[model samples]
Target: MNIYKIFLLISLLFNTLVLQAKEEKISIQLDWLHQFQFAGYYIAKEKGYFKEENLDVIIKEFDFDVDLVNGVLNSKASYAVGKSSLIIDRLEGKKVVLLAAIYQNSPMVLISLNNSNIKKIKDLKDKKVMLTPDARSAAAINSMIISQGLNLKDINFQQHSFKLEDLISGKTDAMGCYLSNEPYILDSKNIEFKIHNPSEYGFEFYGGLFFTSQEELRQNPIRVRKMHRAVLKGWKYAFENIDETVKIIYEKYNTQNKSLEALKYEAKILKELAQFEEGNLGNIDYKKVEEIKRLYLLLGLSDSAINFKLEDIIYNPKKINLTQEEKKYIRNYQINLISNSNFPPFTIETDNKLSGIEIDYWNLVRKKLNLISAIEVINNNQEANEKINTNANNLKYAFGTADYENINSNMSMSVDKVKLALTTLVDKPYTTAITELANKKIAITKYASYYKDLKKKYPKINFVETASINESFDLLQENKVYGILGKLPALSYNITKKTISNAKISGIYNENYELRLHVNKENRVLLNILNKAISTITDEERKLIRDKYNSIIYEPEKDYSWVYKIITFLSVLIIIVVINNRKLNKEIKKRKLAEEELNKIAHIDGLTNAFSRRKIESILELELNREKRYNRGLSLIFFDVDNFKLINDQLGHSTGDNVLEKISSLVNNTMRKTDSFGRWGGEEFIIILPETNKVQAKNIAYLLKEKIANFDFEIDRKVTCSFGVSQFEETDCADSLLTRADNAMYYVKRNGKNEVKVV
Candidate 1:
């Protein structure tokens, strides 16, 4: 206890106290009751990873009333574990920010027994389905059901009791269960069951996401990034050493009283969901998140029409991993930017300056990569290719031209995919199905890279060549071609414009359009620089650029002087003819007006714009004769709006009329061009499905039911329809066929509405 020794002891004690006081305390809310699902948080705390980052972490287990999102938003917790529904929450104006996606694919699925006979999603239709109240509106479960051609309103949904015995006791035919927890229990009991995963139906979603409020991220970004890093590290360690993690969880964090073997099984399945074998832990793909957002919109889960920026939703604190040589290349070398001027919505030459999405992206890339460049507008891809091949003007690094396939062996392309779409007029006898394009005329721009390949693949297709997309559209408008094939972005751009009315995107081109940044392979550093630049450009920026240019009307400059001169000549000639035969002209005009009015009244329904009853009868007669002569399958779907009179009484007749018009428009847009849709009478419609049988027609009816049930009508009213399907028999005439369809429809109406019945 000498004076000097006592002072040294006091100094060490003071430093220790300071270190302890500086450690920041934070808590994370789990999404469900404590189990191995939150094992990463437990491991991070146990292994002192959070402590190493100067974080004092508290793990909050979920309860029946715990709101995971609100817990974080209201500052009750610093972070939270959530599922894909966070996407809908964010779109609905929640300030939640995602830090990491622990599970690549969600474990949420509908489970049933082998003996329950609920094998497919449609089988659960009228069966007692149990779901947790929280999961009733979950994006993964609901989207799968809707995507499988079943309406949510049609299913018999029961509140989940969260007990496995209920399902075993035949109290519930199917239950929304977790693949990680419930499946392990059923397997232990040797229960033979079937899994209906949303992924199987193309509704894959991320699971076990770590998220925090934007306020926390904005106020303490460094701490947030450190916490994110530590959590990912903990996950990596947990998956690699599953036995040790399971032992730790069973000892300390097993709030659910899980057995050792059960925890081990959970960890095994979680490892697969984590996708750690790919060696990229906690990595989120922008494209995947964008798709989930779109699915939410499609499922009517998101209330707002505003688009959420994926960059804002996903957290990426790391900078571009560029090598020193690539960095130096970016600083020293100036890029030679070549663009195709005729590529609408991507590149366009206006006032000798190229403007479009490509230019906008280049500007952002330039600012991010810190590269100096100038854009050169080359109207033709052929000229751009020649310049790129020859390295004209001794250019060292050039990029941003569309035609990059096999142009030069020394050139390399960026790792981004682009696609083209087939578009056709909606009213014409053309469809989006590629198999039906045989012997049909399709217009495509000349010098397109896939033109030769398409011609070689489908020799029977007559691909009409045009100088540009504008010319192709001209051909389409004049009814000279069945459809037009062009860049997908261009087609999307035209849809918002009045340039092409009543046009629909039929299908995507089979061959991928190889449109990417082309750099000389010899310049590897430059190639790396370009790749890094493109990868770092966020989807939000791309969307903003697309929206800006897609709104622009990009009709090519045309000389209308010759057309005016022709009109003037015709006007003079018409004047002379009118003067010569005034009385005869008046009589001809009167007769023509009468004939036009009669044609419109006879052929088209005044309210819904569908074909009139007489016209539909004529069409049905023609289709029946065709089927008889050719011996092909033919079926009809007779349907009408359910509770039509009630809607008219409650919402007024105008609202009812609007519903009919919308239904007509929806059917007209979705059905195949060859299939004829017409208004049979008030609140009734018929579809003539040529070459389709009863089962196929019933499937179509189911699709219509799902669509109409989900469509958002005015006054927040849900609209549904009753459908009846019937196939023509060998001895059946047109009248007999109609009678059968009509009878089946009435049967559906008699029994509950909003269902399809086949006869």
Candidate 2:
């Protein structure tokens, strides 16, 4: 062999080693001692998901005094895992943002012997109740009591030494134990026990939260997205291969010296706590998160005002890889998606046509999959689940929450999740905590799986079980009940629609409940195909659905309604205005008629050619009186050019004035006589809609967004507007209505521009 050839091979090997060294290095800091709870990160690292993303991840196990938050804050680690304490830190205005939820349902429960008189939380009064100071269980117990209108003073609190012997000896009335921990020992010894879960009584909480600093998330979003995807993929792998995961935890990751049986038991309960069996693991529940905020406020963890937003913690998942077989399956198959009408922000039905987040998401899937699709709208969860469960060969898939348990596990799979909450009248609000609603009347259609135990526990509450969700809201509106019960994006949809007013969430429900993309159990090929498609839906795409439907903002080119009534009216109005002006101009040219020009100036805006301030105000006055007489909904939108002052400062005032004129022309054409569009003030515009609620008004605002955005401006080119939307109340005057709209608009301005907000 040639010496030159040998040298070339050696150089090639060295270059390969150098390329491998270039992988982006990062470290994860874990809170608490090493255990199976942190097994997902270990699995991700071992399986090369991090390597596949060109990342070199370092795992840093934590000790008691390490301060997991400071690790990310001071850059000791790129990311970390912490418990409920992280929520307290965030609500206290900490700099970290939670990335994902590791445990969807908290494991903390009050374990007591069935022989004891303490059955309900109320029964625990004057009895020895164990409090584990170091764990979230104590917090959970306190939360449970306060939520039911009881305080810690009512209970006989005992400081636990983390021993099971006292509780087993019946020396203590009850012990706070993780369902996976000491409870397992009791089960092994055949000790009968009754568990009191705080979550079942409306103390639902997120256990383990993954986090990073706001700066790190923003500065390294690509890194965040990559790590988030890999970690989630790792969780999926761990749950699917439980034995392997348990073996890894027992042999490799365990520092507690947990036996294989104990490790396996831990793994099983972790899956239960995380709701891994139901699916859509590692995602945060935005609704429950809001409840956590409220719970903390109730628990005195936060002050009266909450400074942090849920968006501060929640994140979108990045797409993962797909196989060729899965790709081929989607391309060749005709898939049918299960959806229900009136489910806004998810599934929407307007004028016999479908739109909203689900449509947008599935449409994207259809385009990518190259599949012909059909929407099967089963308005009821029970029916949808039954069809999919009993008739799996015919009915392929549907959307459901695990709380429903409507989908029989024999034939269904939960591919995703969503949060369910109860809506109550803000003016006459009721307590959401189950036991507190003892005698109060509340409305609900069908109870989810979580409700069965609640019903058995709180029987005194007068439940106005309705035939359907629509009826539930009707009951609330008629004052037949104190509150209405349902979940989002349905609850949010109805609220946005203004079908229910003066309503706020008094209670949020479901522990480990998720939006699942359930497929037929028998259809393995199709299941694999859809699972891959859902997994690969990118963060940007998810945001497009999750965020878009909430606002209902659509691009100008996307036409929702079939009727071109708006187009026809605008064309005729333009033609009439043009012909009259042209004729008027000829007469003025002949007779020098200054009077006609003066009349035009009086009625028309000089800068925008839209209705002048006086004309629009007169229209608003008439609409207000008419609305008062008929007793119907009337809404208004206030909007303004986002950077008008900037444009005027940079360009001449002429360009700025022309921008207002152009925006007016675009918006004026989209109006009905029932609606009025005018310049409210300099750079601000007002839209009045008679017989329109906040929901319908939002539709109008969304429709006009893209046109204004894409308007062809020659100089000082940027054109965007912030909008505030509101509907009239019975006691509302024109001033009050306008004020609400103004406030809503300012909220948009303060947060971010070029969006719509409703009040």
Candidate 3:
């Protein structure tokens, strides 16, 4: 070969080396030991999903001594799996942006044996409880205890042994465990245990928070977006082919030395926890983050009274796939915004800077679309209108404008609809009826579009013109007018702000209009982009924004010690009279009456407080007779706990009884008033739905099944029920009706528990 040929070969090799070097290298630090919990990351690496994005990914297992978050913050890792504690981490000045929420429900729960007597959160008060080091950062678990009025000091806390044997051998009465991990081990060993999940008592938290540093996101947005998409895709694949994912994890990534069966069990539970069935794999819900923030604030885990913008922590996934041309436009064009500063709460101008719901809304839209230009706040609506009319192409957007009226007018979707209401003094005899405002003087803003129409419709009403909403409210508050016609949000804000304490929203005007950002007809791309961004805003985000502006900060209550002291003295005097035998005959008579009351309630179940089996049977018989006469539809739902026998055998009969009572209470509360529910037998219950068909009855059964499936039973053990529905047929007898329902229930049990079947 010639020297030139050798040089060409070297050149080809050098080009390959450069392309390989271009593959961005990044590491993701796991929060725990290698398990199926990090299956997504593992699968992403193994399946070349990360490689597809030109990423050289490194998956790091958790360390006992190192801080997972600090690893990412210090640039040791580009990303990490965090718990809800990242919210506190952010509030505490750590710059962490939550990328995706893999686990819709956190698997953290308090676990104990049947003999531990720690059935509920309150039962753990004085027990020896073991908590892992990370448990301190588990906000939901702590809030669950605190919400039950128990302090951490109440328990003899111990460090986690991280051994199932410790719990089995009674080394600890209770311990913080993952719902996906420890419970599976006990199930394999045939050991009975209980779980105390925080979500059962309303402390729902997101687990497996995929996050990165804010700096990382800012510096490499495209990289971050690619990583997010790949990771979620991995999770979707992992759940869809669980057996295959389990085989890979057991064969390659199982650092915890987990058996294939154990790994498979963990995968199943984690899949459910991930809400894979609901789709949108790794989607972060802003409302859930809001609740977590509220919990953190309420628990004093973070700074109090802080106006934490949830969007600051949440990574807004790209909602609209922009074309190359559209992207180029967004990169080049600037937003010339004409905001209505006069609109309170919607748009507020102070210190030459505009702020309010609409302004914040646009900011979110601009950020989501990755627009290059900032919102240029013009002076006033008139100036904005004049600019748009003269230079429509230059002035791209304007707020406080009427809905599309001209051929040149184009608008993005409305951020919110403007609902009008009449505000008056609380003492006024005004209702939601517009007729009540007839023949009365009402104050309204002169600029209102409905002004002329309202005047024409209510001819008897005397209309008073005002320049602004504040002026109209002032007239009503000052008693110069019977009521003020204004926007609902403005009125609500004023009332909540205590600007006019005695005023109330008496009636809502029928005419409502949309409050949208009017885009110039010339900028159709901008309109489409704005519409997409607006569409991506969740209802929860909108509500949070509205709440931020109209939040009611309650004033401190006046001390009432004097009144309390008087009541205390009277109560003590009454107690002394009763204890001193001043009403001995009355007490005896009261005890006899209580006995009679107890006897009268024999028809009620002793444990669940539902109707007794005999009473339910009698009622069912009467219902069948009524169905025969009236020919009205009637149905019955028969159901029972899935693993109730195992619960009794492992957790003891006492815990089992508690589970039964909880199930009954949940079903009773969920049943309609016309429905008669009762305990049929051990772990079994029945409901009679009168005047209902099979489809309607099936719907009710599914609703009850969901309620039970979502409920946290004694010790947080997941309790599921198989439901059977049967409608009354003209030829059906009582036994035949029950048998059909029973057979259908057996079918659900034979197929899979926690499902509904109707026949």
What is the per-residue lDDT of model 3 for residues 350-372, given as tens digits with 9 covering 90 to 100? 89887887788778877787776
Q: Best by TM-score, which number?
A: 3
Angstrom error at residue 297, model 1: 1.3
How do the candidates rank by TM-score, highest first?
3, 1, 2
Candidate number with the higher lDDT (2 or 3): 3
Candidate 1 lDDT (Cα, 0 to 1) = 0.76
By TM-score, the better pick of 1 and 3 is 3
Residue pairs with clashing backbones, model 3 = 195-715, 195-716
Model 1's number of clashes is 0
Residue 626 of model 1, lDDT score: 95
What would the TM-scores of all predictions be? 0.43, 0.40, 0.44
lDDT of 1 by residue, 513-577 (tens): 53455654456666556555565555466677656754432222244679899999999999999
Clashes of 2: 7
How would the candidate models be sorted by lDDT, starting from the highest? 3, 1, 2
Residue 226 lDDT in model 1? 67
Q: What would the per-residue lDDT of candidate 2 be over residues 1-759, giving only the tens digit for each residue? A: 799879765754553353243578999987645767777898999999999767899988765556677778888787988766666667666778887888877777888888786766677777887764435323465676665556667777776655678888877998877777777788888988888886554345677678888877656555677788899888889888989988887878877677788877878898988988777477786755665665576558555364776776676544323456766766677677777674565677878888876677667756655666788888876777677676543343333223234443322223335555667766644344556667888776664433444456668978777766778888887889987656546666677677444666665555334354565557676655454456556766766666654432112323445558877888999999999799778976866567767878887887887777888888888888998899767899999889889999999898888888888987876665457887777999899888676765775686566558866877746688999999989888888999999999999889978889989
Model 3, which residues run further than 4 Å from truth?
Answer: 1-21, 303-306, 319-759
